[model samples]
Target: MKRIVCLLLFCALSSALPVYSLTFAPAEETAAAVADFERGQQLFHSGSKERALATLRTSVQRDPGHPKANQAYTLIGRIFIEQKRYPDALLYLERIPAVMRSPEADLLRGYCLVQTGDFAGGQAQLLPLLGQSFSVQDTELLLLALTDAAVNLQQPLNALFFIQKALPLAENQASLLERAHRLLQGHLSDIELEEAAFMWQGTAIGQDARLQLARRALGQQQQQKATHLLQMVLASDVTFPYWQEAEMLLQRSSMDSWFNRDSIGVLLPLSGRYASYGELVKRGLELAVREHNRTRLPVRLVYRDTAVEGVSTSQLVSSLTDDAKVMAIVGPLLGAGAEEAATRAQLEMVPLISLSQRAGLPQRGDFVFRDSLTAEQQIQSLVRYAIDTQHISFSVLRPENRLGEEMTRLFVDEVRRFGGEIVDIVSYPEEGTDFRKQIQSLLWEDYVVDIPPKPELPEFDEFGLPIEKKEEDKKEPEELEYPLAPFHALFMPDYAERISVIAPQLKFYGIKDVTLLGINGWNAPELVERAGRFLDQAVFVDGFFSASSQPEVQRFVELYRQAYEEEPTILSAQAFDAANMLLLGMDDATVRNRDDLRQRLAALRGFRGVSGTVGFDAMGEAIKQPYLLGVKRRRIVEIN
Candidate 1:
């Protein structure tokens, strides 16, 4: 069997077909606008495109934000696209607000752009839709458009991506087959042809691809391979229109093969030094699988423990891949383990979502996803909130360590991005308890040298000799007046243990009025118990907070407590959310494949889970909007 080489996303867009878009119910606007839009839609459906366009225009003029207006614009734009009126279609489509526009509208717009020979812009719009749709029809349609654009752009491999996905979810198999035949006869080369053939291996299109491969084999004088491929094609369902053709080729001579498409691997350190952490992750996976049990897909969970004293991360993953026949892997929490698994997974083309926070982990490849929160996220969250609250100037009190330095850089970048200033950065020894010097330096900045005081001139006696000021005769000078600290916000992106001590010390040193900014580490209860009064109104961002009153979050905390007999740790929350996302994506068998899983992860948006809102960036790194919480009455409270 030919391996589906996913060398480029561009190759996935190898052909074009009718794409679908999303639609929403019209908001209650002026009855007239609604009526006009409804009428326009009816007319359009009734074969009066021109009348419908007029009515839609009238409706939009009355209330552009109305659902009716969006629907009308969508219809009008799509009609113009079908008519090859690219400019008109774009004009109509652009009127609908992005938030209100449907996937269908976006797809149609892309189609129109492509039709006008704007292939790049067309693909730009269409590519993002890969795993977003809740509807298979929408997905198929979008894939079709991508395939056509890719083929036209001479990226036949891109066509393979679209067709393979389009094949499995094809409600309109006839349409896909027709497109495939056209692509095979025209743009596809031997390699591209092989890629497409393997994508649809069991489906009807697979048979077509097989037939082509066989013919190519015959042309190449490889009679045995030709007969084998032909036999495979003939073995496909007779419902396919070309079954007879397959038989004719098969009778010449051949061979065959089959594959099992069930099982995913869960690799965790279940019985070693990292057992506790692995257990938390495992619970999350178990919960996710239990929840997904309702779907009843044939896929099974194959669990492997990478924790055996002698078992290396590579060995553990290899066992699952070679022996277990797993489709994807979720695993090993430690950075070293995650890196090993990532390298192996990337090399093998297996999808792996590592719940490790190692910097540059996901950079290993497209197949490796770092679902854990990163240092950048922690610092960026603190900086963003500080800026949003109009805190223009900031100070940093970080530990003298690599983490502190890393966070400091990230904070500085974010501050500049959002137009804020860094007043001072003071780093104390990581293990130091007394930060008096750092705090003093942050405030006073070596005042003896930086702000030298002028010597007092005493009154001279009758003689010209310099007279020393007597204790009884001279007046005493008042206390020195210190300048106010330059910054209004102080960022400390370290753990609560050190932060708790540092925060109180800052107050003792009179670093008042500056908002105390921290990352998830400060979300600990110790921060509240030890420094709550000091940090009142102080905000810290976190990926998960059990204290959140959000109903879903509350439910998760409760369930976690009941299941684990303790409060859910950040590890549990993050792992649960990550696993949940994978489970949800796995609902579609067609999308459960390693490559498909990665694509689906990128397409996830605003996925609300125990670990706050979870999404993935284009690079497959976690994109979470950290919850900014404040200390109030000795309790952590959501800071809006």
Candidate 2:
């Protein structure tokens, strides 16, 4: 019965035909062929590819019409494909007659055709199966092959269609969407494009089609037509993927309608988990605006709270750009919300300086800029300082958590790049207080304590009788080893709360004369208040230090204290710098609209702000050195 089942599976045919067909063969010959086929399958699974192919071929030659013959052919073809022997795979796959060919066989053949550059043949083989029900994986393969074929043949419409079909199965959806937009733009006629726009309605591809049409209208000097098309997109869906481009087009069509050069939009989470952060950033932006207005031609500040229910960053950005017509935007302080706002600002073609610490926010577009200090920036500054100070060898005693792992990885990579070696690495739980074991692991063999000799036992008597014993020799107790620390430095990528507890433990273990490295989290007052004696001379990095003697920082801090009557945090300082950069750029008479403001901000260099000397690189990331700080006399102070 097992042999019969194996034979039936071997002869299973195409989707349109019965899997098994009635055939007569001598029992012995059929059994031998089946045995060969099973052995070949086992050999293939065991990685003996050449032997498996030889076995499968021998089975096919044994009984050409046996049910196992077709199975052998299929396995042989699959092996060829695996070996990248495309022509061999094609040869075997073509031998299976079309009427008996399984969907799997057709897929294999299509793959071979594509690999061999016979794209048209591949399309012919795979396109028919698109209508048939197949496994998700097989469907993905078909669409990928078709996409490749169409792209090779310069058939943009077909390639776009295949990509749209593959989107649900694609892991890299963003890449496919981007490729789809590129394919549709300037690749199709008006009528064909209109069909696609209608087909993919409410999608990025569809919105891009309308954008292309608007571009055509503008090129032909049809201002009203272009404006109407772009307005249609914005009116229907503010969440439309390409709405920003549409808004920009509409603004270009009628500059007077949405070009308030004197207005700057502010998007912040003023009511939620991040409300406090929003308030800090708002205070700084407000201070900078007031100071800017006093010097320049008063620019109006328009504020929007992102935490409003039923209102998204998309709608807020639309309101700011389309209605308030702000020349540029300041922030959405949190990561997720900041990314959304940046995407909208990008599409709207308004310059936005985001204060969120999210990585790659600026890559959204040319208009998006990030002014916040990031984990990478902090680590870079700390590692650079360590290398500069000749701290050659290091050890890491980090918390067993995500931030700890990330910072440790960054530190190790940077040290390796600077030709320094990491002597030891260990982690302690964030919730733990006893770090003695973890700290002990970082110490060298010289630090090991000596074991005292066992106390001398009394002399035993022979034959159950006590023997006279001389007085035992006296020995002093073994002393503990207190060796000098081996590593030049130790990096603890955790908060000050944990550092205070960990510092004394290091001292208890005789770990001294080693430079302690830290992230921004160590810049707290409690760090000094709790462990000042242990952490004296410890260095850390941060975007802002209120006690700094820099004139710009002093002025900003004084103004912030006077207005809010509270100490400003890094959030406030970064926002102030971002807003001031925008406001200062707006002061230029040539900056008449958002485009001009974007150019001015992108080209900004060496503008001193409270945070640091603010500038922008080509990717719109802030170019500034974070402030290096250290504990001096138990006080956190800016260090040279």
Candidate 3:
């Protein structure tokens, strides 16, 4: 069945070839040139592109003035284009005599220019071919060229005019036409619409008039006619441009659609030592799925154990890929496993939502989305809060290991960039026990000594007390004083226990005015309990703050508590986010292809999640605004 479907799809794609004009020569042409031209045409029709190109080139060179030669030259250019040899194609195309240059030649030349990265030149060549009678192939290629040129020129709105003009020409090439139509269907800004239309106008028009009509009908909200037209169009060519959109729309029109159901997949490290985290993630997924289903989301949740106890990552990927029913795969939260999963998901075109902090994973596939916050983003949040919200001017602290070192470097760089300064940077080994010396050095204390140059005979009365009698009899020695500048804030990248010990000692040295700041790692209870009074005024940035006033967060917190009987961690929130993102994108499988998914994900906005509002950038990285929290009465309290 799969093979049959694949074969059918291939046939559909093949039949959707764009229309192209075929110019015939006048009887005045030389017989040799005419014979060569016919032979080249046969070769082109036979798919012997290289031989066709050579024959066509020879014919054109032999009889440059012959109409047959001009036709052969145009055909040769198209052959080169099909072979993606744009430069060679352009040379032959340009050889066509001015009077022999047909619309097809101009279209082919335009396509070659685009292929050769001369978008502006291609646009100039193609604009003249607009409104001309063209083959579906020629029209589709021309529209594609126009769109590419417009986009390259950053004139998105200008692309739309070309798309509208080419829409009717795409009768036979339904898929290409539909693509062009869809590219312009949305409420695109002037620039975007123009660019999209221009790009579409360059492509060849397909023969499927019904597909074009359906797309137009759909654009006009003529749902029933659009659906019927699309169905008719797909009966002949399922790979039509509007095929995916039609299918999705048809499914949507039905009350019971797959999209309305709770389709979820959970990825976890069920077989390794991190099994506990996996179980936690599974619990979160289950909780969210259940709640979602209860709301009549019609959802179903599935779990995949990304455990390679003895097998290789390849084996794990094979196991996962075998399950065609899986919609979204989440987990394998371990860094190595997540990386492997990312690569595998990219290959399989499955969305793998990683729950690990390894931000170095290159966001590749649309299906391979991550829920983890990057260190750079986290640092930026902290810096913003410190500089803007808290008005902190100076920071003095140390980082523990390589990660900490990198974080410290980022923090310093951001601080300086944000008009802040670093007063003192104390580097401490992770294994260091006593931080007192380091703290004292940063305190900038002044040492003063009072002594007499020569000791006078003691003029003591009863208790052998050397009480000075007169000011003249007393002498003062020179005193040296060292001044130390005070820092307004301290950024401690250490874990809770170390920070706890360092915090109070800093206060003891009359540095109570210095506020303590910490990173996400300091959100642990151990840090609060061990640090005790020292952490009273300290602030930190954390991912999961249950005190959020947002209803989504409140619901998530409640549901999580009911399922796991424990508070949800940032990891759990991330898992939830990953699930939501995958499900949201699975709405349109046609557009759910890897690249499409990646673009959609990047353009997502205002998506609410337990981890806060999650959005993605062009690189497919998650960007979430972190919450600022303070340790108040040993509890993490959100600071507005």
Best candidate, lDDT: 2
* Cα error, candidate 2, residue 290 (Å): 1.4
Cα-based TM-score, every candidate: 0.57, 0.61, 0.54
- The sequence of per-residue lDDT tens digits that candidate 2 reaches over residues 305-359 is 9889898888899899888878788888877788888877776667889888887
Q: Tens digit of lDDT per residue, candidate 3, span 111-214? A: 87776678888888888887898777677677778977876675645555566555667665454344444333322443443344345432332313344444
- Candidate 2 lDDT at 337 equals 80
The global C-alpha lDDT for each of the candidates, from Candidate 1 onward, is: 0.73, 0.81, 0.64
Give the Cα error of residue 2 in candidate 2, in Å.
82
TM-score for predicted model 1 compared with the true structure: 0.57
Clashes of 1: 25
lDDT of 1 at 41: 88
Error of 2 at 199 (Å): 30
Best-first order by lDDT? 2, 1, 3
Select the stronger candidate by TM-score from 1 and 2: 2
